[model samples]
Target: MSEWRIYQGVGKPHDGIDRLPAPPPWRDFGNGEGEMTPFDRDMPAQGRHRLPHAAAYQADESTVEAVNTALYLRRPLLVTGDPGVGKSTLADAVASELKLGAVLRWPVNSKTTLRDGLYRYDSLGRLEEAGVAQRGARQDEQPTPASLGRYISLGPLGTSLAPFALPRVLLIDEIDKSDIDLPNDLLDVFEEGGFEIPELARAADVSEPVMIRPADGGEEVTVRRGMVRCHAFPFVVLTSNGEREFPPAFLRRCVRLQLPAVSEDEMRLRAIVRAHLPGADEQAEEIIELFMQRAATGELATDQLLNAVYLMSRTVKEGAPGLDGVARLVLQHLNVTAPAE
Candidate 1:
């Protein structure tokens, strides 16, 4: 069980500046094909988690190329656009394309700390040990990595840096929600390819820790000091809603990609639908188009269109009404409460 602690302190004023990593002299080997070598074969699969393939929805050829660049380069892809413009989906799509595990999401917020993004040490277990020792109960504990591992579970940010051939996808969602320092803080890990866990590092010198993994139906991945080395530098994707400006130093480390709104011709929307629902009929496409147009006018959420299509299809399969029913189903899926009649 995880417990969250809220820390209170006098808030400091924003200086609007922080130290950032110097850009590595990256050589543009952008060959005509831009093919990248696969991750090392011998690398362990500790932090390399894969995502569900069907969820990946690529907008076009350019989008695929952009994602490939970020993945091969192992650099942060800064995706900016209006809300619901699939900024976050880019990471998911990449993970799915590569068959990497579920996208590790770090939803940024004003109060989110660097430690929160990295890893947190569990103090409860430590306190329990202190209590046991205070009563003068002498006990010999096994040096299993599992016993020393609970304090060192990596957060999404730290997990992204795990050393493995198959890299994980990390979506830093809505980074604009954070203060200016967040991006700068992230630069080090992005460049260095990993972060150090002080707790695990300290314990590692004592004994070779064991990693406790789920027993197929197990619930947790309990890891010891040397049991896992997450060498897989994550294909990091950071998204913004364009709420705030970023310093140049932070931007230099990442490749910036801007996604425009869905076109009126409905090219991207149609493509997304086809990718998501290959066998969807004409009625489903029409309903999805309607939802997409409606969404385009307001807070255009692409996921809502997907939801609408699924709901409409289910309704039709159950032998419900036609276009009107489909529209109603789309609206219902979007949770757009019926307007005052």
Candidate 2:
């Protein structure tokens, strides 16, 4: 059995509503033509990075259910939670447990756009290279069309939508920070299972099928006629800090799940502390109690507690002084309001 229960549902469930009858087979019905390389060959050897303490991180039942639902239905999972609640880490856990290649990440910002997620074309660099080629050409030699493939590279979304033998796992971090239109803009791509690259499309006649680099960085793949479509839809995990609301249309297409506060459970808090600071004993309980008390009064993130535990553990191990004062400083709540006089 896998260390995590989430991986057990890889291809088993089929309720038709949230689960598909079977995994979608790889098939290309669009203008794009390409083959997905095996995970061991094309993917980076490092796999997804995991913290030493992440082994003990646990997910609630609802969160696990949401992940399985998204996997079976091939739908994007919209995870909303407070900061440091492990919204983004969920994608890493899924990729790690399922043995999915790598997590293609797109960190969203206030200015992020839909096109930014699809691909980026370095026209200027290509032009510079073309100039160099032209100047070096002999009197009888002619420069061929600048390699369009060299200039274009796929982004997170495009890479996910590429024709892969198995579905790629994608993490769109802090999507709530994106512009209002970004969510709606992603609807078409999510529904269509593909997107077109106009730059490559315009040059299709000259460049029938070109090998281009994908976002994940590895061997290049052939893109036929500038159209990139997916045989297997990517398992997309979009995270938000609950800073903004999304359109109903966007929400309709996604499976939504909210992460509950960890401070509510004493056992869970202890587990997190033990994972991060294995040496912590009675100190772990004291710190967790203090953390819960502070959390109950103001805005606090789980990482703050972890940081305190780590510092205290290090201090004790090194026989350092001022452990209490240091813990107090690091464990202080982040609330801006002034404490009672």
Candidate 3:
């Protein structure tokens, strides 16, 4: 197994690096007589869509420094880079390294909204459930208190802000793909460290601490008075493909870092390749050079290189020289220049 370096705070405040005190644990907050369960902290080493490259992914010093700065300052890291440059994978790497549990990923599309990322209340579902209970009950019996807990669940962002022993890792993937107003809407929640669920708030007066499930489908957590606040701010990673520009205010609140484009650096390429394709060190140089050459001509992603290498490796092991043609198909450049209109 490869040894991973966890991000410790910087020694002094320099180049936007500010030292910060350790975040307080959830236990520090007072817990009244109620069932208080922490967010699921037990994340398996592998899962569907989880990055297998997390353990061995190698980041440059500057990227590492920026991540540490974000951690210490309790600010979101806005990572801008081309697709497949490992923007989304950064969240996985950090979570795996810091033992921060499963990453809460909110994949943004044009239809995604602030409410979609926070929480969703199924009012209709609750009403139907209530009606069923009332019909089955005796004339004197009362229906359940809406059973809002069953209908209301926190989304990825909401779950991240839930008071946890340690901060959770949140990946707001491809913010550039979201609607224009989405970025601005996120500013308030990011600064406030929480949001209010109106449905839960209205019922707060009548109910005990409501137990709600998060989007991860993990253990239930108790939300007091329908407001979800972070005892420790989540380690947020917002990725962009440089498709759209963000407002000044949103950019100011985030710590921005742009990953390097294509590079011929042998060590960097080897580290990345070795993570996905172990024991391919002998073929790293040849494949990495070919990848760089292709990337120079068009918009080629790093994953394309990995795919090509994996196919080539299989062919070599099986002594199938004829399979070289099939391997070339995988290495084709994804982007072609548009013709003049």
Candidate 4:
């Protein structure tokens, strides 16, 4: 709802096909032909994103629907779940479905700050320039705009706000790992599409004033007012490991979804097969079933199942594995002896 003022381009606003540049030969901006191309454009056609057919995830249709809605609304998705339950995978799923782009992951930690997530303003470079300008300047001359702005670098959060037709998906992984106030700070930035580059704002420009774009990308567009407006609202997905609770104010604005630890049956070979694991062997099923039953007592995590499958696959690939091989698979891959009663 907040608005940021933007200055007009030095040239006239681009129009029609001429305004649109000739797309790179390889990329598909969605308007082209039958097959999907990888090329990203200034403006991409917005549409519904299809999710991957993972049975474990699909079992919870509400969760999927919540995520789909978040992507459509361009709001933050809060995922709360046990560790190793594939909370982070949701972001990947959304990115894959929309063919939007890889998730711009912002892993949260205790020390993570708003500025850390936003772009870094080159403090040292700015200091060095100030020194150079001071030494070169005549007594009457004052510091110039060029001396102040070059050292500025935008951070991940700020970069995510960069203007584009297709908004990039931002995965704020494990918000619970950081301090409680982190979410509030993030909310402020999300409400405003862009943040000001303090260094650049000090300079006076007739045509363009504020520089805005992702940190990694080597371009900046001028933004006006105190806020940045989004052309395409970013698909912001925030995951939590369930170590703590969030404030009500923050919770009120977000659509929260919880991912449960996958059931033991969900990890079995039959389950895996149903989930689209092709060429599953009978031997694999027996071993997986054994592990799943033992793990039901809240012992081994589901991640071990993936390891077991890989081992089973390798053994089958290299002829029938003996007892020693199976033991090795259980011990080395699963990282536990037979589950304790």
Candidate 5:
């Protein structure tokens, strides 16, 4: 029933996520917890969000259902929406509300690769260190497992896979901008819930766990036997701008979500304004009307109204020049230029 939803999307931090039921058997992996680092305590929860604490992300019932479904199934959420439509904020909202650690963001680009998201090996650096050690005398002194592991740094995707006490929130932003092959490349990792580090696997000492740094900038995590497995599948959120179509095989593994434009909901828009400025209800209403009117036929985003309400309204109320000009300039369509009358 609806009571089983793990993420309520209420903008209030709670531990309800801890009560999530077992993941599907097919998605299960090793149950070992990630080695905790001293910095783990310092990891920022939802309070560090750019959105105001009042409501970092205003989630309607539909959004709540999509997110909760993703959480329950232990599947990656593939969210598609217009730019600035709060696609990325969904990750932060879930993390903040469920007391998940800071959102791990992997912003993809055309040049991004699967390895770029998983981990980066400093092969050149390792080779350089080996040369230095050989020349300095010490029997060629091949770098120890500890030293070699230090050369490998886990990216956001890699960090999210580490077996941890709780599920980490990963936001793979704008995945549609990635290279065509990137989506297909992710299929294996999603199915396996882990990846292998060949460098460590083939090393002289393959028995010991190697410690590597996580993309979150926390202390190194131990990858036992060159494998990074998850105790709990991370809450992975992959965002898209509807720019490209993904392969069918890749799409089949994800929970898809279509985000409505912010202007479509007047109450949500007002909540966003009031979250930033507690007493801006009147300003919010006025700007909301104007924003919706232009947004009806244009590509104005929600933040434009936030800007107009916070800046233009604040200025006008303080006895400055009227904000008509300011609002006009701030709320312009994304793809057009206004006439300079």
Candidate 6:
């Protein structure tokens, strides 16, 4: 409720984002009315998975603090955690709670580059189309056809950078999975809140401001003079499974949060179970205890706990219900394989 804390984590829609003071001169892109993506429109009807995941997310004290800090500072949250500790769900929770619309996610991989997150142009396709156009045109006339904007579409990361009044939630899942230097490459854009689309920039003189579909879907965004800037910095969540190290500069810019081990939080686990399988409370604790035991041995995911409980509820006939064979299979670790006979 404090004036400085824009995100309350209450999971209710509010205009608090509007009340947020202007970003420090450096982070503020401009005052222009930003475009609204489909997610920025009616969310309840967007048929997105964000709401349900948001409803189920149970934020602890540390999570709430880190989230608010990132929101208030307009910085990316670098969430480091064991796999499946709900690192990525944080984006959905904030988007759903704040009525920010759908989360724009760019799932990073070994081959992902900064440009991969940006717009993609069908250069060859355009070339081929131009060839066809030239062939069809009259001998004395010029070949006239569509513009390059028709071949360009923004990706999730590019769409998030679109000038928007309120921020969109962008989940850069598994940042550690990206090749080295990618995080460094992102620093400039993160600070500038925009990037020049060379394809559009080069054609700026030849074309009017282009109207093109954004990756987030819904509304067409206007790209003027080949540059995209934001009125507000989108809330960015970069998740890492502690898979690799990031450059110190990237670390400094991000509000780093290392999620507490899920096994250590008993009450939190129970709450998660209650949120998911309301009636499974009867055997939830037993399943959770075993899950924690397995988690202690090696890598484990929170979903495995949910999966086990769901199975137990259906199969726990009269008394046989303590981490049964079927449940053990579900609780298997991502890193630890089953012991040989």
What's the TM for model 6?
0.91
lDDT of 3 by residue, 245-297 (tens): 99999999999999877454657777778777988766666778777766666
lDDT tens digits, residue span 37-124, model 1: 2332211123343322235455554555566455555577899887667787666555443445566788899988787877666778
For candidate 2, write residues 253-285 as lDDT tens digits: 999999988888888888777766777866677
lDDT of 2: 0.73
TM-score of 2: 0.85
**How many Å off is the CA of 234 in candidate 3?**
0.4
Give Cα distance to truth, residue 254, candidate 6, Å: 0.8
lDDT of 4 by residue, 37-132 (tens): 122322112222223322133224556567655644456789897665667766655555445554566888999998888766667776676677
How do the residues 207-255 of candidate 6 rate in per-residue lDDT, one tens digit apiece? Answer: 5578767887658778887888776788999999997899899999999
> How well does each candidate superpose onto the true structure, as a TM-score?
0.67, 0.85, 0.84, 0.70, 0.91, 0.91
**What's the C-alpha lDDT at position 242 in model 4?**
79
Task: TM-score for candidate 1, please give it.
Answer: 0.67
Candidate 1: where is the Cα deviation over 4 Å?
1-56, 137-148, 200-230, 263-265, 292-296, 310-313, 316-341
The 10-residue segment of model 3 with minimum total lDDT is 9-18
List clashing residue pairs in candidate 6.
none
- Ten-residue region with minimum lDDT total, candidate 5: 38-47
| Residue pairs that clash (backbone atoms under 3 angstroms), model 2 | none
Candidate 3, lDDT over the whole model:
0.74
The C-alpha RMSD of each candidate to the native structure, in angstroms, is 12.5, 4.7, 5.6, 11.1, 2.6, 2.7
Report the C-alpha displacement of residue 59, candidate 6, in angstroms: 0.9
For model 6, the stretches where C-alpha displacement exceeds 4 angstroms are: 1-3, 31-41, 138-146, 316-322, 337-341
